[model samples]
Target: MAAGAPRIFVSHLSGVAVFDPAGDQVGRVRDLVVMLRVAQRPPRLLGLVVELATRRRIFLPMTRVTAIQSGQVITTGVLNVRRFEQRPTERLVFGELLDRRVVLTETGEEVTVLDLSVHQLPARREWEIDRVFVRKGRKGSAFRRAKGEALTVEWTAVSGFSLEEQGQGAENLLATFEQLRPADLANVLHHLSPKRRAEVAAALDDDRLADVLEELPEDDQIEILGKLKEERAADVLEAMDPDDAADLLGELPTDEQERLLSLMQPGDAADMRRLMSYEDRTAGGLMTTEPIVLRPDATVADALARVRNPDLSPALAAQVYVCRPPDETPTGKYLGTVHFQRLLREPPPSLVSSIVDSDLQPLDPDADLPAIAGFFATYDMVAAPVVDEAGSLLGAVTVDDVLDHMLPEDWRETEFHLAEEEVATDGS
Candidate 1:
């Protein structure tokens, strides 16, 4: 659901029909899986358990759900189809939460949970249980019941749903640091005990884990990856940036690398093979194959729309490469480049080729790290295109990749926590 979508009560979601993009009915909602937090913070709505026509129940991640309406849920048509197994930190809404007894924080009265309301975070895809509807009186027997007052309250107004058993489990730790950026989260993981690190890593969703893995040191990356089940490990790799994924694969034994590659999509595996073929320090290895490539005839409006993508890194979005027929990497003869600023200055309808900066020499696939750094420094460019002898654009290397190679191997050992603590001391 988007920012302005209505909050949904879990009672209304039960047994709702689920449809794919093609409007074909795939299944019916079975239950919702959510992760409870340490404190009163609302639990995150992870996904739904949907039972298919064959009565096989599978987990559908919230990321794939496009919309949730009165009687139906729409998906992206990419269901995993694997049996839904409850993770250690996960809970089922209908089976466990409804009719549960808990105390309201504002008042000393105990209440029975009748339902929970979930909503997507503004401008983000993550959904969380935000409200609790409860009955204020005692639970009635099968035939005889007591009439009770009912009301809805914020999730934080209730306390029993959070940590009541273990004081310091992976779930609590994850919730405590859930809002941290991937790099910061990776840093926290680096400092934890290996067992705790692996536990936390296992609990994170695939896309989030992939992002955190990219920011982690090589040793940490390998340790966490090895701890995961092979199939899930492969899925995480596919979610990662191609260049980063290739780097991780290169660190593994050839047989192990091949095993993981075999599990990936054919196109992704091919990209990995091509990337791993190059020397580690060369432009071909450092660059990402999924750069923004547009045909020369594309208008500035098209280029700007692509740049507006929230997923693109700042460096990758800095400019776009104009090429011939094929748009993927090793694209047809490279035409030129149009920086984001240039695109902005030109009319929306103007052809990108007209303002293309063809003067700058593109980097060769074999260009070494020193040479790549020199090109960035000389041109003051955040990113530069890499082209092969046949003039096909191979990929683009950004300044960050160059810096990663240039930095000392032990640079990750710098303790960010100490700096934060020092600032805290001074403030006191």
Candidate 2:
């Protein structure tokens, strides 16, 4: 290590708050951008990906960074607010490099790159990767003790492996991405090339892939779905919220849609088909078929158990529908809903029907977008149940789905501008 080098491990810097010279927070460090040069040379630090309060990401060149220390990064108070777009030569440290496999040059041993150490070069304004902390092991033996601790080796002692050399496609890359939130992972996937995106998608499990797909743009969604085998694609669709699945399917060619739909489970397929039948802007189209539901005779305990499921969306988990037998959608008569707040207030053994909000009117399946939006605003509800003419419990439209529909058709392409400013000329 260089003397007084101000070295910091990349892992510790990942989410550190970024502040202006006056001490106001600008954003948090989401990722570090670097440019690779020679194979044996340390990659040059380019900038930081800062995610602002509005969830918009922008770039802050390292030149604008004044200090990096415990819990925070201090900036020179000058920043370009244009959304961060990765250039062809840039690599994201957290997304692309961390958790990857690298071979030790001396021992011919494979190890996982747990973290990286970056340091400021002596008497220079430049910072570069100085060392790598690697966990010794092959794929399955990752937990084995490495003489009681992992190795902190100089960067030159290891040869970094690319996704292609791993033989399992991009499976190793997926591990790094998995640590990111679904929205962040979606952002990374969106920036990757089509072939690389497909490879990463292939490595993700159905549930994780479904979450990422829900955050992606419709075109990206369609492209990724097309890359998946029909059966696996159907499985992923099945794993997604029904309304989201329907919306993605609606964007695809009819034949492709039907082919994947046929591969799904009969119940899920039926639900998706029913959702697809309605106008894209209507209540029926925006509703998810899998909202938490319970029989009228079920107890609060049952409802609570269903809400506890980690897979359920927050809106869906916030309440439970109380329906009469047969208890399945379309056949079950629409009754009422029990909010989580009310459910928690009542005794666990009490019947769900006792707390049901029967006075709340459900939206008709054909209700227009404006009508649905009005209902939410009027009731201050996170979700509203949709019913057919016979008052059958069909599904529930979540607030998020309605907002997505209300946004402009090209909303996904809009830059997350922080302020009106020209693009910076530096850091290409």
Predicted structure with the largest lDDT when compared to the true one: 1
CA lDDT of each candidate?
A: 0.89, 0.81
Residues 1-428, candidate 1: write the lDDT tens digits.
Answer: 66778899999999999999999999999999998887677888999999999999998989889889758999978776657778788899999998899999888788899999999998777899999999888986679765799999999998788866457777778888899998889888988899989999988877789999988888999999999988788888987989999999999999999899887877888999999999998999999998999998899999998897656789999999999979899899998899999988999999999999999999999999999999999999999999999999999999988888899775665554664577789999
The root-mean-square deviation over C-alpha atoms between each candidate and the true structure, in angstroms, is 3.7, 16.8
User: What TM-score against the true fold does each predicted structure earn?
Assistant: 0.83, 0.60
Whole-model alpha-carbon lDDT for candidate 2: 0.81
The most accurate candidate by TM-score is 1
lDDT of 1: 0.89
- Give candidate 1 regions above 4 Å deviation: 11-29, 50-60, 64-82, 138-149, 294-305, 322-336, 343-361, 414-428
lDDT of 2 at 392: 87
